[model samples]
Target: MNLAESLGDCEFQSVNTAYDENMPVDRKVLVDNATLSGVERLIGESRVRNLGNVDNDILCLEKLLTAILFSDALMAIDDYKEEYRSKRSRQFSFIKFLKLDHVSYADLSGKAADFARSMTFSFDGSKPAGDVVSFFEALRIDPQLRWDVFVSSEYLTMSLLVRDTRDVGYENSIDGVFRNESANADVVLAGIKFDAPVSMEHHAEISSIKDLVDAFASNNPNFRGSSSGSLLARCIFGYGWAAERSYFYNAVAAQNNASVFLAPLRDAFCEGCCRLESRSQVESLLAALKSKSQATMAKIVESSGQAKFALKLPFFSAYLISICDNPRQCIEHALELRNRSEFRDCRSILHNLDFLSVGERSAELNRILGLLEQSCDSLLRKYGVATANGLQVSLSLGLAGISAGTSIKLDRLFPFYRNRPFSRLFRNIAQDMVNVERLGGLYEKLCASVKEHQDAGYPSRTSVTPKFMERRENEYGRPAKL
Candidate 1:
């Protein structure tokens, strides 16, 4: 009843795929082209290698099924709960739908059928054929195939991991891999809180694995502190957003703290071509974040990690600024600033500034913050910063943003550092400073609060933005306040 036995050579039936012709006009061209290309690649790769590993082939097939299920579930969520629709949100819902421990093989078979029937493929202009049709047919006719095979030791472990992860948060169930009697205290600790019921029953100390993962996930923006299933899905599918992968790997490195079962899990789940690249970038950012002095932040802002991790990676820079012994305060601070009214007016402008970091011209940047702060001197006192480090970090971040050409991001780390309205105003003033000689007048103008700029009808500058931000403008994507 093993996977290899279940997948023994079997005949496959071919079927026609029917696609919806009336897709949204704007998306039709791109979606169709991408789908066609994807199918060709999926089938071509599987068919060519006579020596293809059956287990590997099964994994690839699982990815394809997961993709179809993911897409279908997302559409359902969009229709049912429009407000709670995001790639991450949909993914969360999809895991709930899976109910991995309860889902039957028959359900998987039905899903496979639906996916196969929906996809139409063609080679050299021949009649269109669906890849899933052939794939499922092979499984359908295999005499050795049985639903019970999934419960075999290896798959049962994976199932338990997914099932427990979906029900309890990741921190609670992380050590499920070491749930067996033979697993040591470190392995048990990796999966459960030291004070958790099971951990207490065994009288284990706070596991280092737990500390490492908690810290890494807390600081890494991609994992978003607690929403971990997306990374789990990525580990299965072989590719994921760079941020998610980065944070997930950081958690993995922490598991390396417990050298027992972690290495094997890392090899199995974290195996993709991008592994080395992502690990390097993640480590670099972590090192920068961990440094006690501003030297780390300054160095990162001056290098590749600055744009990729600090600016482009969502919330990561804020996490680094907020790094402390306890992250609850930092998380709360980020959430509060995100929702504050002061930054509400120029949120998009603030976002634009994150992507526009100017590396070398720091003196000009300070001038920008100084000019903008001049107008908001009264509010600065009233804003009431919580800590000295918070204020210092915010000010440094403001300078960092100016050097990069945007300072709105400082709001996330230091709520009172740079007034958003003033940030927009200062950026306008900087943009208007065309002549070196006229810089004096521009600084004088920027010194006025943002209200003065608005009253005087100063023009705001618009910069090109990333595509992901553009997608955020869709009906379901309300700009994040937190």
Candidate 2:
């Protein structure tokens, strides 16, 4: 954020001159992206030319806060690395001016100062690497804050980034700003972590700040201890839910000295080739694999690439049988595809639990039957025949979401459209096709039309076929047609 904006937001005096005038500005840091660069050019030139240096002031505050943040991260790393490289302890320094009228560290005392002291522990004896962020994140997981203690309403908002192993406390106040405790610098940043690691049985836990804290403190050891760092990192790599997981990804990689953080991403660069019929399709899939739930997709990939391919044999066969409809082959495919675990949802199985023995056969039948029932319901619902009232409306929605020009039930279509309602058509043809007797030709005709239309593009989509309607007044044995 620029100066004027932060001042207006924090309700503080807008301008204060720092004599650090000529230290070749950290060009890369200042000009992060085009937007930040623009802010710099506009603000810097303004301050130099004395045209109301608004942006410069906010940016400076942001810079200072970023310093603090760097200090925190470096300290955490130092704790983990234990390299005693720098002698200066990265303690947060207060702005000389936020010192007016007991504003600086002086204004803070008694309960408030004690509370703040009690709030954060200055790097517990253990390495902060994963533990410190977890502590701050524990503070952040309060799904919400009822900050009656805060002087300004702006402090009300805060977010926590928690991975099983790595985490951080981020404030999204008036402007985009994040602070690393040790650096005492303000970074107008977006995120911290970037890529997640690949591992089995990894899951991210997203909950309210209160819930997060509760989980960390109560029962969810993964959120509290350093042990959680790797687990949380793995989950963050998967689908870390709180805020955006991407923000914490890079930050965690840069700071936390844990088990190789970006090993999966590097490994992918080394060995991420996926062979598929469509190269473009595979590339796109691989791209998605980066952000997808890695563990779940891994299961699918493992099954797909297996030597025997037994795990997915059932689904493959079922898919082929759906298109071909060769009953014998479909049965064989269905048998191979079926898994008892897959049919635990079938109400039929739940009902006949005692009589029908549980096995692949039962699961297979239930799977097909379950699919059939669902498909029928889906088709019926699509055609607006979901309810009894809709049933009489006839089939306006056809085979593949198409609509016949006109619709009529079976009895109406046969003799009506052909000028020979089924009442008459049946009398003439019932003697011929024995199959039609068992399932009347009119019924047979309906089924045939349904199948044909399903395949065709009006009632057939690609083809135009006349829809049937009921007719009367002239036919052999026309049974007093209505």
Candidate 3:
């Protein structure tokens, strides 16, 4: 008979099912001898039920009965296994109730065993609120069903399952089964090479940055000759202390063949160090620098990007010389050396130094400033300096005021100066500066006010007097001063 007909003929009688005390008792008791026999008959029939022909109520009854019977079968298989283990029973009660012969029982046992095991393992003494195990069992039973869903969902399920079973002994078995059934099994399995644990013997041998870089390059050959490789190399070198000065030098020198990669390597090293901002790292770098000979130190300072890294930090230049035996000699030596003839590089270093000295100044600051200034002067002399993008560089004279002529000259020379406004505003400033008479009168007024303040007998400078007066009278007469 069809599933609906069989379900329609069944009579369900309330029967109490034994459950662990810890298990929830919210489930309705809907299964009995008559209902179980009806389900068995429905399973035995191979005929497919036509939902269009079947009544909706009978179809619903069929679905409800099927679900209840499936859940009961899952729980019974788990109980039978436990009972068989303890008592060595020759026959399971559910097996006899279903009237399954040897072959049928073996087939049913194999089909339902995994779900039973997973439910028992996951829930332990209590039943789970939902049958998560059955859902996974459906996926295992039907390959086409897994293919219909998004691949990422499968990966998410695998991750969640792994996390849930991490401390359990059966995680590996579950992981192996899921991976074997996954659509991307080849890709997932290939990643195992990278995830393999590093051997202690090999790990112990990575005593220097060079050793670490070599090991990485050996394993990830595809990443070689790429910017990513350079970045990785820089991180290795920058984040750790070297075993010796030679080791550090050799690591830097090895990348000379791909000099184009050096810029990013240097930049990343500097950035990594700055981001860490660790006092211990700073001290380590300083100690490394101090141990080297003057010639070796100069190579590192001038050629290997260490000088730029050190200058990026606040007051590090001052700090470096502070710990030196001869501060004056060190300053003089640094000043005498010539930097690489790159205008942009010189400009960047000078800007960093200026930013560091803001809000405070010292003799050391002046000395460092002189060293960079001398390098810049030397660069300009050698290259015959030109305006950066046709704009003049603006100069700040502290006591001496910025004149209109100076502004015009700066606009002409350093058109690319950061302070230069957009084209429209720049044109307005240039036009205003050209009106020399107006600007001159304003300047004269400013000078007159300054002279008046200096001549006043008040203890402090005051722009306003204590009493108000008519403009004409105030201009001509000496008003009451504060």
Candidate 4:
């Protein structure tokens, strides 16, 4: 049995919440207390705003019921075959978990019963008290969840996003929010790529997102990037190590003081009610706000896309508004959009469909390629990238992930620029800086070779990656040692 169950002796029920006797009621749950977020915030929303259509709510509830997973705990025990991710920390007990797309509840009957109970709450948009109980019980007995505990400090993959605090908070998934230290912990996830939040002056890219997130997760000692990120975001999310809300005690900007606004945010909260008078106090207030905000966010998620799409522009824009303000919202938006049959359409037809008649396919591909060339010309002029002797190089490269030389002539008008397509391929791979530089630098020499086809087009053609050449040489006897 998991440690959470070992402490208690009663038979665990999936649909009934057994209140923890260790939990104190008179004391505030946020101030120097264990952060307990109820699954109700996510599962209990339909009763209050029965205002929305039941069809959509039913769909979303079903989606969330099966989709959400706690990967960290499953991995630590090492018995669960399900994919798992965890966080490394200074606070000792803080952990984060992620459930990927492949896993699901092996016992569907219990899950459906629990979710049905959660949907029948009293609040207009209530929390799922019963749902939390079910989740904990199910996790305790599930073969994957009941695996052995981890002896080493190795954390999970995507779940590296948790705080490093141990004294005041413990990682509890049934609560619907992760609890970790706020003092100085940092949690980061690698490999999950994201584009920067859209902004002016700074061109945000996916690699930049990965790097920034890694820096926060690594908590400085493990982080190796040169850039600095918004410290407030990390602290707000309780991803910092050694820093609890109490650390804000000495700062005038104590997050709870309610009087410490910088004029702009002065009106965000009532005067003196949300001021941060000290560092520890600031931590306390922010931690509280984050706790509350977590619930509100879950509520919003429950009501997500419940309304019908009457007007396309306003509907899409409003949906994007929710997503733009928060990263989780962004993910949910993408998921929702994917489920909509209405928005799917053919984006462009330029790639190879070799089985079709060559003449007709060639004509269609050429027409599409022509349009791309025109667009590239415009982008270069607008973005202030001067077009030299050839066409706008970047845009012509266009759609990513096909082999690098698939469209060599699309970006270059010169019959002599045979290697241009290869160059464009590398440049189009936004996250791939290495190949882009290597390809960009070799373009001129390749172009010259293209012009003097007899002088050494062979070397230009042969100058591919060593990895590919290795495979090729394995087949065709190591070609004259380059």
User: What TM-score does structure 2 among the candidates reach?
Assistant: 0.14
Of 1 and 2, the candidate ahead on lDDT is: 1
Better of 2 and 3 by TM-score: 3
Q: Give model 3's TM-score versus the native structure.
A: 0.16
Model 2 ranges with Cα > 4 A deviation: 1-30, 34-41, 44-482
After superposition, the stretches of candidate 1 with alpha carbons farther than 4 Å from their true spots are 1-77, 81-278, 293-306, 311-349, 354-482
- List clashing residue pairs in candidate 1: 175-191, 356-404, 357-404, 358-403, 358-404, 358-405
In terms of TM-score, how similar is model 4 to the real structure?
0.17
Q: Which sections of candidate 4 miss by over 4 Å?
A: 1-325, 339-343, 347-362, 369-396, 399-482
| Model 4 CA lDDT for position 354 | 12
Q: Each candidate's lDDT (Cα)?
A: 0.22, 0.20, 0.22, 0.20
RMSD per candidate (Å) reads: 29.5, 37.4, 43.5, 31.6
> For model 1, how does the per-residue alpha-carbon lDDT over 1-482 read when each residue is reduced to its tens digit?
21112223221001001111122111000011111112222233212121112112212222222222112111110111223224323322322221112233334323323322222221111111222122112111101100112122110001111222233322121222112111112221111111211011121332232442343345434333322221222111111111122222222222222101111112222221111223354345434533533231222222322222211111111232234222223223434443333332123223233333334233333332232222133223333232322321211112234222132212221222232211111010010111111223222221222112122321111111222332233322211111
lDDT of 1 at 339: 36
Q: What is the TM-score of each candidate against the true structure?
A: 0.21, 0.14, 0.16, 0.17
Task: Give the alpha carbon lDDT tens digit for every residue of 356-388 in model 2.
Answer: 222323333333323323322332232221122
